[model samples]
Target: MGSKQSKDKRTKEQKQLTPEAVQVTHSNQGPRTRSRHLSLVLLGVVEVPPHVWELLELQRLNLSQNCLSTLPPALGQLEHIVVLNLSGNRLTCLPKEIGRLRNLKILFANMNALTAVPEELSLCGKLEVLSLSHNLLEELPVSLNDLAFLRKLNLGSNRIAHIPLCVFSMKCLDFLHVGSNRLENIAETIQYLQNLQILIVEYNNIHALPKTLCSVTALELLNVDHNCIQALPDDLYKLSRLRKIAMHPMDTGLHIIHNPLARPLPQMLDAGLDALFRYLKDKDGNIY
Candidate 1:
């Protein structure tokens, strides 16, 4: 009987030392140690402890695969955090205080239940990658244009129908994924993305391609598959740097007419054609 009692006590003690238990303890830690960096708490839901406010020096935090329903306002106390992953959570909204993280660089919040993003997120001036895929967002804050250092943005599988013009003005943006939305048209202002290299707008309701798209001189990969596009502008052949262009099979057979006197375009066109054809063939094979 005494051995059984002792075993029960030991089991209870072991359960109390779990990471969740540790988090419960750390949450109560005072603000004195708020400057410590690198906190990870994955696979379980736990509220942010009040003690986390003391870790002002934190640079990375991963709380993925948890049942967290909301972020603590005290998260703003981590002024030095550079990478934050909160994916696979039950969060429905973000605290406005997140804007205080001026040094943050990468933010992953995919597979959440977010309905809207706070405009305060635009305040992360150093953010480079922002992933918000598989959410329920219908629109983005116009202030997102203020992210001068942003490079990659993913908004796949959302209910968004229209993109704001301000989104096209991000000068440093290189990659943009807007697949599986309800968009019927792309803003003409997209021509201003001079630095963009890859643009994926597949599986939308788009009906036509904007002629101004040719102005994106640095574009290399453009995916517009499964859309209603029936033709392409002849001027598309002018993009001397394009390497791949993915489109529906019905949109093929359109060739570029280059001015031999201006510059060489055949080499780049050949490479792009090869890549596009390969993609089409692969897609066709899957359809059968």
Candidate 2:
């Protein structure tokens, strides 16, 4: 009888050592043994296994063009993720735990159903490029001003009507796109963005230019066409680096300031003021 009991105990131990059991434990490997670099393409609604979080050294995650409705909170366990792309999904909001990714630099959350951004995202101190266009956002989180290192921000094609004055405080921002919205004012605070180069606010309801905008010395391209604007501040001509300016014709007329050394104005400008107004009105209606 004692010999029979010993044999039964051995058989039970063998059953626990099966391949399925080994897979559950993942071989008791350290975090370093798991894949540090992971890319999932065309994965449809991937159900992340609990064990996958052990790969905590991940740096980039591209889950674009998937059917994911939300991200697992376990993703925040990856402390090293730098770039995250969740575009072309149906996510309505981001998990607050996402704030744990302190090293994240680039985030693409465009083309989603997001109605609002979590204020916790401001915790990502290193974020540089953020694209939240094509969403249903009505307002931005006030905490967004805390992102000191942000450089590019795209909020096109949303319901946004006003940009908080605090955003103008981001000294590093260079490219800003807020077109195709309901905006009616050019915040005077925008003049504080000394490094701003490209500003696109076309297809809105703005009716005039802010004199303070001339302070942006680095501006190169300014597209404000398709708005109700009827005048251009004389200061606009002083932007030495500006190459392209798109606007509708002023209700008044274009007057050339006399310059002794400058050659005769280009034919486009020399065209009588009446002709110039007609040209601009036609261009604005076609381009925007």
Error of 1 at 123 (Å): 1.5
Model 2 regions lying over 4 Å from their true place: 1-36, 46-52, 245-288
- For model 2, how does the per-residue alpha-carbon lDDT over 1-288 read when each residue is reduced to its tens digit? 999998997676445333232221122576555433444435554454455466666677666777777778887898888888888888899988889999999999998989988888989999999999889887888888888998999988889899755478778999888878889989888888989887778778887779788778787666675677655554554455653323332321122222121222234445553444345445446432
Q: 1-288, model 1: which lDDT tens digit per residue?
A: 999998997677445434444331233567654433444445354575565557565667777787789998888988888888888888898899999999989999989999999999999999999999889989999998899988998998888898655578688989888877888888888888889877777778877768788788677767676676654544454455654333443232322332131122334445666544443345446321
Estimate candidate 1's RMSD in Å: 10.0
Instruction: For each of the candidates, give the backbone clash count.
Output: 7, 0
Q: List the residue pairs that clash in candidate 1.
A: 27-49, 34-54, 34-55, 34-56, 35-55, 35-56, 35-57
- Minimal lDDT window, size 10, model 2: 252-261
Record all residue pairs in model 2 with backbone atoms less than 3 Å apart, i.e. clashing.
Answer: none
